[model samples]
Target: NSLAQFVFGFTESGRFGAARQTKNSLVINMSWGVGLGMVLDDKIFRGHNGFAGEFSHISLFANGRLCACGKQGCLETEASGWALTRMVKEKILEGSSSILVEKMNGKGEIQMEDVIKAANNDDVLAIELIAKIGDNIGRGIALLINIFNPELVILGGSLAQTGEYIRLPIKSAINKYSLSLVNNDTQLKLSQLGKRAGIIGACLLVRKRLLSLS
Candidate 1:
């Protein structure tokens, strides 16, 4: 995996961040994309690459899965936006009976949100599909906890809207693989900020930067 094979290099050379300096960072490896961190001295730990706290990759694959980055076995292959959407498309095409199928006007042209809505309404196939994605998400998180060893993990983004269905599996996965010491200090929880998490998190960064200038 590129993440492991180049972890040290990325952490040092800003490979994971667009920033030119090694500032403290906040890495948020969401189910769909990768984010970097920039912290320093008990704060965000921005390595050379100004990317610290990123953990969307842990090689939890089954030895072979197609990734958009052209990687054969990355976490993105299993639980990312790419992965979830792929799964949804396949399930619908498989003739599965789901509200999603109905939403597509009896066709199989489903979108990500459609599946989420169908799942929320208790569609059998939708639930099964979501659970499958949740399982993969959990597996990815387990690898993340074992590697980054963070103290707290908050899951945010569109998928978070799925509610407990996503959290339960992720919690289960982390517990299954994290070392006792890591798990003891770490807590897995959903994002409480709702749709505002992204904007708020970004605003926090801006506020911190402005304060730093003061």
Candidate 2:
């Protein structure tokens, strides 16, 4: 709740303070772990206000789905960090007979790391769960492709460490949803920054502010 509130406040203030630069301004952002994207040329491309590049919360489905944003079938409901943890927790709870269960010692309190470990070992339950997760994630990205027509998409986060286990599904989704010409122009990539992207991006923000004061 605190983070969400902070993000909302920051966005509100930034929007409130922007100098309305109608030039060839650029905003390169790494967020949502759906990947990083850049905004160039005209248009904020973030929708109305700062919500354009908001990958954290979007309608993944139109049905009655519940989201942290208190919305139904939001993309974050099934694709965000919170969503990943929730799925891992639920799979462990299902007692679906996985090595994951053994790793938890029947306590059923597993995290994304546990899921990844179990998946590495090729645990039946872990494999299936990860695949399901990859599929859900792919579906989410597919939604973005349909909407944004972005030039590139980068995968990063603790979860993206899973490598092809995750990217494959996202690629599959892109294949299925986007047209060949558009999708081909769109390069789906893994983050070169590794796990440091968010931290680095934040630091870059502060550094820029300092430079501007000079």
Score every model by TM-score. Answer: 0.74, 0.72
Model 2 spans > 4 angstroms off = 1-37, 41-51, 88-95, 103-105
lDDT of 2: 0.55
**Model 1, span 135-212: residue lDDT tens:** 777666666666666555556556767888777777777677667776776655555555554455455555667899
The C-alpha stretches of model 1 lying farther than 4 A from their native spots are: 1-31, 34-42, 103-108
89-177, model 2: which lDDT tens digit per residue?
67667766777656567666667777677777777776665566667666766666666666655565666666777778778877886
Q: What is the Cα-based TM-score of model 2? A: 0.72
Q: What do the candidate models score in CA lDDT, each in turn?
A: 0.57, 0.55
The best candidate by lDDT is 1
